[model samples]
Target chain A: MPSAASSQLLDADFPTRLREVAGMVETRLDALLPKPNGHQSVIFEAARYAALGGGKRLRPFLVVETARMLGGSLDEALSVGCALECLHVYSLVHDDLPCMDDDDLRRGKPTVHRAYGDAIAVLAGDALLTRSFGILGEVDLPADVKVKLVTELAMSGGMSGMIGGQVVDITVAEGERDEALITELQAMKTGALIDYAVRAGGYVAGASETELAALSAYARDMGLAFQIQDDILDVTGDAETVGKAVGKDADLGKATFVSILGLEGAQHRAKELGERAKNRLAPWDKAAQTLRDTVDFVLERKH
Target chain B: MPSAASSQLLDADFPTRLREVAGMVETRLDALLPKPNGHQSVIFEAARYAALGGGKRLRPFLVVETARMLGGSLDEALSVGCALECLHVYSLVHDDLPCMDDDDLRRGKPTVHRAYGDAIAVLAGDALLTRSFGILGEVDLPADVKVKLVTELAMSGGMSGMIGGQVVDITVAEGERDEALITELQAMKTGALIDYAVRAGGYVAGASETELAALSAYARDMGLAFQIQDDILDVTGDAETVGKAVGKDADLGKATFVSILGLEGAQHRAKELGERAKNRLAPWDKAAQTLRDTVDFVLERKH
Candidate 1:
């Protein structure tokens, strides 16, 4: 295991390094994709809206961290992180569209549909979704690892996981829901992609089966905790702070952990889950401590 | 080269075999994907609308045919075909969203957004798009080949190509049209993916560089011809037969080859391109004759 001082250096420099890596990845993403032309104009514009829009670089950070922990270069992990971000942004763009969540704002700005209209927003999401794998496939990685990573991403983001969770969330929003059902929904909708991000990063780093299993468990716990925090924040945080309309979840009668668990209970659960996430990383090198810290930071985040 | 009699056998039985392979491929797709559970109702329903809703199985048929041309098993190619179809369906779903094209119908049925609303539709498209690569990654093929196939698919579908073309198309739609600009758009929007399908199928079969180049050229010509024919069909074909609204190009004032070339000129160009596509395939074994025939069929089709 690396020394505590070295690990501290990783923690201190991680954000700057991550941002630099993200910037490079974004450049590569831009360089690789051809501008949309002809009848596909709206789709292209929408893709740009979704992908170029700003968000936290958490997934990419995981890709880099996991890769570094596994003795892989950051360059190898850059594409994976960028791809994950693309997938994340694509989901947000589509989720905020008129027909799905009907959200008009995200990340402190107009959502893709609000900025570019539904046609372009929809296409933007599609383009981003496809482009995520495109980035991954272009990266110089072992073919088997690449295949595994792509498969994991697809499954996590697809019908059985994220989409599945969204379906349940929407359906339950219109009708009745119980605690069990709501928990299951969050697990699928939010948990799946988060799980994929950590696992994918581990995959790029050549993590062993035990490490992947541990990382997956950590992600699953962290994801649920993160969503719970989000729900809590929706009630307690300012709209300006969170970058979208707050309390909208309550207005829509959306089922959430806070709604069912109550604020206090939700907070408690988040703390417990964060602790569990940290425990999962106990066997990993000290380099992974920041990931554990992120679990706590995510749960306690004000925005 | 194989005898003309072999070519005749391939043509006569190929579609039947292809259909059978499609059925098997569909089953594989069904098995690989998560079932539509109540939680993911939106994603599940939308996926069904886009994927199971009927479209000509043209891309999948091409995959099967190309695999056969290379003396590979159709069963082996079925997953690849299914992946391509998922990608095609994903694009269509997003393309028809209210944000993108504002399309209410597809294939004479309500589009995903119309049927399920926009949010679910968007997620559904995202799900399908991600799932396509997932299917490709998991297919029982060599890892190196899978990597190559994925790279090809991503490049064809991503920025700098399909997405990039879409951007140009949208920008150009807001400006005066030119022949060169229109051709560039067409190449990226349609030609890139079509080229990918042929090249990817060949790559999966371990095709030689010469074979890949020939197939790619053939597909490029066919793709342009196909788009031109589509433009012609938009003007001449009935909406009911075409399954989507016709004359949309005229209504939107979107620039197309037909709009620029005039109807007669577009037809002539399509015919000539179809012949060129067929000629490009001349070096292939007689088994490739069906692909050549399909190009001609695409150009001559009434709808």
Candidate 2:
């Protein structure tokens, strides 16, 4: 396995290619969600607002890289990546609604609710959520693969995964929560989507069983590490830097990894998890090298 | 075509058979959405609360009937019916949120938000919506059929249909809405799903172009009639009888068919539309006889 420092030494062309792929995905997403004409125009606009609102598009990147790693065409994974991002955006839109985290900011701008009012925001989230499946189901892929990918995406996003985590997080916020509960919540809420990103990419590429197993391991560890770092940043990062209002967890009385594990302990866990994630990718081809760098980037990013 | 009086003459065995089919569909839905063990338990429970909460199960019934109309098995259409119901339930859950209609009752019980709090309700809706596609995609149908069905469902549920109509409803409620605008909104919000119910059933049965076209015409007209009757009921029905709070549209200052067209005009329009819907299905076989009856039932029902 490449060392963390070595992983960062990616070819100069890598960032350019990644950006190009991201741009392509963005265009396709725009095409997939056309603005509705006539009476319900606002709903379509609200959906577009939530979807087009800026994010790093990291999930799509993972999808493209994982597909490439398994010797699959990026074209095959393009719509899948867009679908994943749509699901992610939908989750964020709902998460920031008045009933959930009740936040007003997202990605350095006012959230859907803040921008479009609560009713529109709720509908926007619903539209984006349903639209993801539409994109996936309409993609030109093999039937079995399409079924498998769609099933995996649903399981990851639904009660068994992301939604499940959100419920636990809400309960913890409303009452006293322990370290174990907090970790489990984080895994479901934040980690499930990331894990899905990696696995979905692999599935689209028709990765071997061994490769899939390895990728799953890598994703699980990376997802947890990413969440831990997020918790650490919530404590230490500024609102302007983090791109959302900071310290809401403390205000909400929510349990988090940093609150339970402590800053140093959380950092230690993240580093260990990142290393483990990297180790899992050791059996993959050179195309997976970018994914390894992504893990390191997850650990090192300040925001 | 079955006469209006003939349509009312429910086959002595049809209701019994429908109840049986509904039971089977319910069982399948339960099997498809099993509660995952551990931290995800709360999500599963909330999902069940919203999903299993009893309504007429009208959408699923339509799916089964339309499939049978096209010489397909109810067994084959079971999952499709279940998926449509899932989509319907998800919409209802979100629509009842405090930010939306702020409804406190649904199906003679507390709304999802009132019962499970807003966060869980939101997540529950998200989970159900995603799970619908998952169910459709994973069913043992041809890939092309799955794709078409999923596409139809998503389109009906997304910007051009349900969500769009909702946005228009909310917007027009803030001001005086014209008759044309109100009709457009109804066509999208209510008509879209109703249209999809028949279309998806035909899709699963491998419907021909002509049959699909005829069914679409039948569905479109019936859907409008259904919405018009719903508007009339909002003005005329009692809360206890309807199982939901009545006069919500006027209370929210939302324009409706009744509001824009007057009660007598709205009722006349419903009857006219119902007739048109029935006429469109005249070319179909005896199996479509039940569907024609359903269109009449939609307009004539008290609740």
Candidate 3:
């Protein structure tokens, strides 16, 4: 394994650190997405339009920071991080399709389907998802590491994970208020990728078993906390700030954390999850401060 | 690399051997597809419906046959073949969506979207595509081999391959009839995966550069021949035998090989391509008989 230089640290605010990583990730993503060419140029164009030019880059941040904390190569972390971002953006593009969530706006711009039409949106999403795996395959990592990352990433986003959650979400019967089902849906749909992002960082670092376990725990709690905050934001935040339709969950009568737990109860649960998430990284002490700060950011963010 | 026991061959007819391979692929696919479970059971069910008990298993047959001829492990070949099938099926499922091909029938049965609703169908397609990579990741091959397979498969099916072809097919501007453009589209959409299927078997066998080159040449010609035959069948074959809508290309006025070359010209081209494809395999002599026979099968197939 290539040794990662422990970069010098500054006591910068958490948002500043996040923005810095986001900027780096964006540059990498721009470089990574395929250039448009020939007859099939439109799909590449659509894929780039969807993947680039938007989003929090939260997953990429988690991947990079976790690898940094675990003393993993920054370059490898960025590749994996960019891959995760591609997968995330593809999901968003598909989710915004007419047959799915049918949303017009994504990241405050017309959704892929709206901008490129449904067929192109679907094809672009397909392209992005395939490119995600391709990115991992091409990353300068050990063969074994690459295999594990590909396997785990596919599992996280496939039938039993994100896709499965999406099926459940779309098929939820009206007036069914099962928090357990809703939680499972959220965990599978959203939490799985988030968890994988952190674990992927650990994998790249070749961290010890104990370190991996801690990261896994940190990711699980943090993922739930992130979702809860999203639900909270949907209720409280405006559409312009949120970048998409808000309160649509309520409008469609879909069950959410806020609906089942109540707004304050959901907020309390998220806080508890955030605290637990931070506590999981306690053993790493100062090295994990950035990750701990991330939990607070997940809870406190308005959009 | 593991040594493959060169299995004894029977002097069986070509159709019999093809059927034997297809049966084995179907059995393996049955075992590989994830079983239905819990809230996300629908996607799994739908994926199974689309993947199992249908199609010619042409790609899988190519993988297995090429590997067998090259003296590669049957088990590894089967796994790779199954993975290719999953990827192929996913593309078919997505292509049959209302906003795409809008075909209600596939393999003489209701399409995934027709049976499971559009949302479930979309999720099912996503799951299958992800599972295709996951299969490659978990295959008992050298990790480098797995990574290469993953990368190449993604490239064959992603923005520059099948998905790109589909976009061109859908977005074909009216009154535009460019044979070169159509050929490019067909090569990307259909030929890419077919080429990859044969090459994957060669990859598994650790074939020499010369052998790989020969396989590449054979696959390229065979792929075009197969596509040309498909166009001919679309015009002349009955829907019941074809197991899907026929005459649709003509109905849509799509620029197919038959449209551009005329039926006799298309037939002549396919025959010429098939002969060239067969000649590419001549160096292997008796060892490549089954694959050479596949060229004849491609040209003569009614469906």
What are the lDDT scores of the predictions, listed in order? 0.76, 0.82, 0.87
Q: What TM-score did chain B of candidate 3 earn?
A: 0.92
DockQ of each: 0.54, 0.71, 0.78
Task: Give per-model TM-scores.
Answer: 0.87, 0.91, 0.93
Candidate 2 on B102-214: residue-level lDDT in tens?
98988778888898889889888988998898888788888778878887888999888888888877786556677877778778888888889888889888889899898
Model 3: lDDT to the true structure: 0.87
Top-TM-score candidate index: 3
Q: Is the docking of candidate 1 incorrect, acceptable, medium or high quality?
A: medium
The better-scoring model by lDDT among 2 and 3 is 3
Candidate with top lDDT is 3
Worst 10-residue lDDT window for candidate 1 chain A reads A1-10
Off by over 4 Å in 2: A1-5, A8-18, A173-179, A234-264, B1-10, B173-176, B234-268
lDDT of each residue in B1-303, candidate 1, tens digit only: 443333322255545654675676667667655666565555765686678735567887788778888977677677788888888787787777654667877777888878887667767777777888988998889988887878778777766577667666655544577777788788987788788878767876889999999998999899989999999999999987876679999888878888889999999898788777877877875567779767756776777
Candidate 3 lDDT over B1-303, as tens digits, reads 111112123235888988889999999998888889988787888989999996778899999999999999989999999999999999999999999889898877899999988988888888899999999998899998899899999999988888888888777784675778878878898999988998899888888879988998999898989889998999999998876679989998888899989999999998788778877887787788888778877777777
Candidate 3, superposed: residue stretches over 4 Å from native: A1-12, A236-253, B1-12, B238-252
Residue B241, candidate 1: how far off, in angstroms? 6.4
Residue A42 error for model 1, in Å? 8.6
Interface RMSDs of all predictions? 2.7, 1.3, 0.9
Cα lDDT for residue A10, model 3?
28
User: What is the lDDT, from 0 to 100, of the residue B168 in candidate 1?
Assistant: 65
